[model samples]
Target: MKHLFGNRVIRLLLGNDLLDNIAIWIRNIAVLFLVMDKTGDDPVAVSLITVAEYAPIFLFSMIGGTLADRWEPRRTMMAGGLLSAASVAAIALAVRYGAWETVFLATAVSAIVSQFSQPSSFVIIKRHLKEEQIAAATGLGQSMAAIFLIAGPVIGTAVYARLGIEASLLLVAALFLASTLLVFWLPRVPRETDAERSGGLWSDMREGVRFVLRDARLKTLLLLFALLGIGTGLIQPLDIFIVTDRLALDKEQVQWFYLVSGVGLLGGGVLAAVTAGKTRPNGHWLVAGGLGFLAVSIVVEAWSVWVPVTLVSRFLVGIAMAFMQTALSAMMIRMIDEAYVGRINGTLAPIMTGTLLAGSALAGPLLKATSLLAVFALAAGIVAVAAFCALRLKDRPSAVEAADRA
Candidate 1:
């Protein structure tokens, strides 16, 4: 544990993830608030903002994953970092020009850049670390990002209050630049071998998909993750509307709800870091996390139906979310073969993108048709399905170290 925490490469990687995460937190909250303020529309409009943001991940994530396999991981990551920085800068410039709609467009462009960044980052870790260290590294990386996720909203809120959302955008852009710099210091990682390569781009993607489908473990993991995404997607939009309408809360107060959840996220990360060295009870944790998330959804979205309860629900959901994400990513890193690791991961991106879109799209119709409680109940049921999917995974001993790449 000491060695894991103290490694220089670990420090570098964690630092980069942390800054990028802070930027993400700021960017997410800022965009939603900015849209609501400018448009004065309902929660549906805010959700649409997210849809635009994630649409590219659906389109290009597999391509990004294939590229990660074909190229040096460090170089891929560096390029991603640079693209993210440039996109962030573009948003800042748009804000400076008072081009609000253009800012949304730039935000979407930034998301597309992230489609390139994340798959590369995941593959880099998969290529570099030992299998034993992979969980610890993944946990620690997520933990660092969680820390930023925990803190960034509060900081962004303060920045938003003092200097407006544009100022927050500028700060986020700066963080991306810092992340790019950290990428510069990261160790180089090799590309996948000829055996891993497919005939052409489309063919390569097809091969990756075929590989994932053939692997029962990979298929199960993707199913669980997709279900999890769908369950949460239902709840996320409700949280905003609950705060805005049901609770009749102001923007500042809503930011506090985000802050509370961030704290829970941090706590979950601590737990993951502490448990990293132990044999993972992967199926158990998945079920527990999913159930916990379901419980939170019920409490906030269904039963209590109040602001404080919603905030607490967000926190509890964050806790469950942290465990699920850390465990699942580590599990995937262990289960997949080196050759198809990038592609296998890439395959999940579209699933996530689809689920996110579903969540955003459903928020509107559901809110219009029924009560918020019904929407929340729907989330809980979806999450239960995710947990059930996890039960189907075949538990296996952790694999060989994830260190060497082709």
Candidate 2:
């Protein structure tokens, strides 16, 4: 752990991640409440916020990723941060002019920029960290996410409640600016070779698709991502119903589930970080185990009317999520060539996003058409299929292992 943190690049990357996430959570919550207040709690207006945030991933992720491959990682990240800050500042100004509805543009612009910046982070991770350190780094990063899942909402609510919309928007803009400055300190890394840059954007994208298709491991991971997305999407929208319909509790009580799950995720991430070196090579097994456990948890959550049982199931689900995320990150770093990392990530991401959106779109209709039990059962079944896919993953030598043999 000391060794990992001692690396200057890792420290900078993690610090930037921390700042970025804090800003995002603050922005998301503040914008959401602001919209609610402005629109008198109209559900359609509230839902549009979600659309603005996620719609960009569908539109720009692939292109952004392809560009990340051709661009310098450090510069790409810096550009994204700067662009986000500028857009948010513009939105703040617009809001001040009583055009408050344009606030959705803030979320949309940030989300669009993130698709470009996020893949650059993976490139930096691949370039800076040693093979053995990758898992620990990934785990530590996830730990930060876990922490925020627990505290971010509270912090965002406090800020917005105290400062209100205009201040909150300005604060978000400032945070993005701060993040950009932080990224500016990252050491410059070598750019992609001239040969890599020679291809046109569409050509590069096509190559990325072919690259994933040709790798059996990557292909399997892609399928697993799609299944997990579907499973998660189906259940995510129904959490409140789990409280209201299953546990016979108030919808407001759903917070307890999130709280317990966040706690479990924090513990699981720390455990993964501590054990990463030993477990990195066996990530496929970890992923499989995590998915299997998650599937069971979902099943338990589905049937159990008891509050304690459901809470415990949700907690276990959090732990499973941490382990699966850590394993997936380790696998991506270890398995894929760095040159194709951005393109591959871009390619695989939309499959998951597209499937998740599809599943989310289906969830309400499915629930209305059937029952809560049926919807949960279908989600569990999808995740179980993903677990089975993970089980079928054949172990292969990572670049580090192959190097040692050579």
Candidate 3:
């Protein structure tokens, strides 16, 4: 922990991540509520906010990632931050003029910029951190995200309730600007060589796809990602129902589940960070174990009608998710070549997003057609398959070392 914090690069990156995530949560929650209030609680209007936030992942992630591979990582991230701040500023102005609809643009633009910035962040981590430090760094980074996942909603809602949408937008913009300034403090690194950047954009993208397909480890990881996405998505939109229907409780009581899960995630992330060194070499085992636990937890959670049992299951699920995510991230950084980091992220992210979206789209209809128990069973089944895949993954030489050997 001391060594992790001592690294200036990691410290700066973590700070930037902290601010960025807080701002994102504030923006997302504030916008959703504002839209809800404006549209008289119209479901379609609320859903469009989600579409604006996520559609950019499908459209710009690949392009943004390819660009990150070509551009200087620090500069690319800084640019993304600046662009996000500027977009929010514009949105604030539009809102002041009674153009509340334009608020969606704030979420859309930031999400688009994030597609580029996020890969650049991974590139920087791969370049700057030692292999041994990667796991701790990844764990720490995820821990910050976990913290925000718990606190962000409350903070966003508080800000919106006290200060109104315009002030909340300003606050979000300021957070982005502050994060950009933090990026400015990051050490500048050399850009990719001309030889490395020789391919056309499409060619580079194709190569990235080919690279993942060729690497057995990466191919397996992609499959794992897809399965996890499907499982998580299937249950994500139904948690409220679990409270109201399954537990025979008030819908408002669902917050307890979130709180319990968040606390578990926070603890799990810290555990992952502290044990990262011991666990790094056997990341696949860690991932598998986490997923295996999650599979069981999901089954228990879905099957239980008792509130205490359900909450405990959800808490364990959060812990399992944190461990799995930390292991997966560290393994990717250690296994992939830095040159392909951005493109690989771009390629793999959409698979999960696509699967998640597909599962989410089908979730309601599936529930109406079948039953909650059936949906949860299917989700658990999918995640169990992913765990099995994880068990088959064998640690090998990093991509750079393999290329050199060839």
Candidate 4:
């Protein structure tokens, strides 16, 4: 008997996804370090860079999703890849020329362009797959993505150390181009000729927003995720900063923290995959995972000792993150109509995107006013609220049907 695990599309996506995630992680870590290095530990500058990277999802994500609806996913991916390639190349050149201002500007622009690619990705994947496959696909995608989290910084730092930051940026640029080629395997999408005629892009976006708000459960899920985002986002940059500054780790050593967290992510993915079929009610998973995540963050913040304690805490948090992500994504799939997966996915993007921005922007001020440890504690408190909200979500009949069918 062929193992269900041996699906070809899953394998293909997983392989390319690992490389793709590696590129993204490299770009992100490099930009964070580069910006910090150049700007001399300015938290606002760091926050701005994070904002630049994610803010586009809130601003242009609808446009990107609408474009995805109109065009072929492959073509959209190609365009996005090319645009990302150009942006990264420009950043590389800016660094080479000692144009720090240009470096920050180019990085921001690059992030904006990269967001254009995301909606198409969600649409394309939905168009091709069945509902049951989505979770596994998400699982594998996340697993490989976690692998990148494990390796990207270490590798990026190595390249940055030996070959300079420009070289790493150029490598990232090359990876984007490669992602373009990989996406070419995706089927062609018929363009939305009626995009203008069909109530304009703004109207389409409004409809998506209205649909989610109108759905009782979906609105709840969206808000829950928003709170989740705010919770995690607050801790993310600060966590890295603390590891680097408080723990006194060099660049390469800092990667170990992520590596430990990545291991937890991978372990959680494996658990999700193994137990996906066995589990019937995913809601409990979500609740438990969220609480687990919050607990880990609190413990880490309070007892943050040497590297070992931090690593252990972060690893447990990573596992919780993995479980939470799996459950949340599954819940998202259950809430939407399969036909409008793209639109539904698009609708959720803003909440996730905006929440991150709110967290990053807000966290900067909070960090300035209080201790970083205090900030982590507050974030944990927010997550506890979210988890409480999630517990109130009564599992619907439809969710059960979706699970049974899967």
Candidate 5:
């Protein structure tokens, strides 16, 4: 593990990743609270921020992927990072002048650039990391994500509550600046597709789609990822409402929840790192079981069991998500050609975000019609089916070979 970070490029990219997530987490917490304070906790109004965050992925992910494939990862990452910092700074200034809508606008603009940043991260991984190292990197990435997830919200909210939103935004902007520097420091590796890669953006996107469709394994994985998206989306809309309205948790209690879930995610990430190589044959099971337990946890929360159970469930869900995401990411890196990594990732962004958007919209309506328990049960049931169907998927010893042969 120590040797992994010994690689200069890996260390820089990883640092950039941590800083990037820190900024995102802070921004997310700030915007959520901002909308909440402004609109009296209106779900629809606050939800717009989320919608804005994801809408850009739907609109620009493919283009970003194409660009990543064509451009140097370091250059693309640096560009995106600087642009993100500038945007956040702009938002901070706007907020100071009493422009609340700038939060959503900034979020949307940042998200649009994020389409480029995300693919570039994967591009760095694929180009730099060896086959044996990929799984470990995935686990490490998940751990950083978990740490940021835990710290970002707590710090962001605490800073906002004490110092105010402007402070939170400034903090996020500082992180972004740090991340941009980290990106700039990363050594540039030329892309594999620079010479032969040509054609319009739409044509390149079509090739990406055709490439995935040509492979049964990629096709199946993509479908499962979509289901993962829907399952994730189902619970998201209920989070704030449940915490604020149902549990009536004060700000402090929310921190405790974050602590428990962060610990869970950290645990899961460590476990995944330890088991990455060993879990290749049964990666889908990890995802399936993760999804299944996630649904169960959601149902349990809806069952009106808040305290230790809800806290425990949140932790377990973190574990599940980390396990699933780490396993799948490792598997994807192992199976797919490095050249297609960006496009494949970009291709799935929309499916995930779209379903999440839909779920957020639908869950509210469902809550109006049914109890939270019912809504949770629906998500659980759907994911349970996905898990069961996953059982039918053959555990190919060589997913890449299987895809190639197909």
Candidate 6:
């Protein structure tokens, strides 16, 4: 673990991801409270902000991933970080001006920039790390993500409460700038080899899509992925409302829920890393199990308005989510050829975001027509269906590490 950070490039990139993720989370918290303050936390307004965050992944990830394949990862990432900083700065200015809509606009644009940034990071890690080192690097990344996801909301909301929205957003901008600076020293990685090249961007994209669809198991896995997206998307936008409106927790205390679940996420990452060499359970089952756990959590949260039960269930949800996603990623690393890794994952972004969009769209109507408990039960039912599909999944252990279990 210590040696992993000893490598200069890995250290820098990991720090970049850490700072970038924290910046994004802080921005999201700021956006959530900003809209709430401006619009009285209107459901439609909140949904729109969340949607804006996801829309670019649907629209631009393929183009960005294709470019990532063709360009230098470090430079592309640097450009992305600069754009992110500018976007945050623009939003900070927007906050000062009371231009509520521009906040959403800025969020969407930043998301578009992120489409480029994320793929480049993926390729950088895949290319730079040795095969054996990949899992450890991934574990490290997830661990940091868990930690930052926990801290971001707590720190971000505190900043907003203490310093005001404008100052908090400026803080996000500073983090983005810091992230960009960290990448300045990363060595230039080479472009794809002749054998790695696809004919053109469109052709490469089509090929990536084709590659993903050709495998029945991959198709099945994506179906489960879509289900997970839909089920959770329905839950996420309403969380603040559920806290303040439903559970009646103060806005400042929302961090408590995040704290509990984030601790679970960190613990899960640690547990998975400890077990990775010993137990590479079938990836599909892990995902299915995770979804099932989320379903159970939703139901538990809905069972009573009592906060402690909901908190514990949410913690379990975090643990389940970490284990599931880590398994799914390891499967991808093991099964996919290196050349198409960027594009294939890129194309899947739409599948994820699109279903989430559908789920978000459904949330408002569900709330209007039914109670929160009903909505959660519906989410549970949807996730159970995903789990059934996962149970039907036929993906075998193909990666050397995972295959050892088989």
* Model number with the top lDDT: 3
lDDT of 2 by residue, 1-406 (tens): 9999999998999889988998999899989998999889999999999899889998999999998888899999999999888888888899999999988998999899989998998999888888788888888988999999999999999999999888888898899888888899997768767675777889999998887777778888889989988998898889899999999898888888889989889877877777755764566677787888899898999899999899889888888878777777677667777777789889878888899998998999999999999999999999988988997665455444356457
Cα lDDT for residue 209, candidate 3: 88
User: Can you write out model 5's per-residue Cα lDDT over 1-406, one digit (the tens) per residue?
Assistant: 7767887878987888887887787788888998899989999988788679877888899889877777788888888877888888888899999998788876887889889987888878877877667778888889988887767767767777886788788888788889889888777877656466567667877888887787677776777677777776777767665566567776456667667878888888887877775665676676677677777876776665457677778788778778777877777667667667778788877876787667777888898898777777888786677676566444443455456557
lDDT of 1 by residue, 105-153 (tens): 6568677776666667777666677667777777676667777766666
Error of 1 at 340 (Å): 2.0
TM-score attained by model 2: 0.94
Q: By lDDT, rank the candidates, best first.
A: 3, 2, 5, 6, 1, 4
Per-candidate Cα lDDT values, in order, are 0.72, 0.86, 0.88, 0.68, 0.77, 0.75
Per-residue alpha-carbon lDDT of model 6 for 26-104, expressed as tens digits? 7788888988988997899998986787778878989887777777888998898888788878877876776767788
| lDDT tens digits, residue span 293-371, model 3 | 8999999999999989999999898988887777777787778877788898999889889999988988999999999
Clashes by residue pair, model 2:
none
Candidate 4 lDDT for residue 389: 72
The Cα error of candidate 2 at residue 148, in Å, is 1.6
**Overall local distance difference test of candidate 2:** 0.86
Ranking by TM-score: 3, 2, 5, 1, 6, 4
Q: Give the TM-score of candidate 3.
A: 0.96
TM-score of each: 0.80, 0.94, 0.96, 0.79, 0.84, 0.79
Higher-TM-score candidate of 3 and 6: 3
lDDT of 1: 0.72
**Candidate 4 regions with alpha-carbon error over 4 angstroms:** 1-5, 26-48, 90-100, 189-192, 195-197, 237-258, 281-311, 357-378, 392-406
Lowest-scoring 10 consecutive residues by lDDT in candidate 6? 395-404
Looking at model 6, the pairs that clash are none
Q: Which stretches of candidate 1 lie over 4 Å from their true place?
A: 23-49, 87-102, 157-174, 192-198, 240-256, 281-301, 305-314, 367-370, 395-406
Candidate 6 residue spans exceeding 4 A from truth: 25-48, 87-105, 131-136, 157-171, 193-198, 237-255, 304-307, 367-375, 391-406
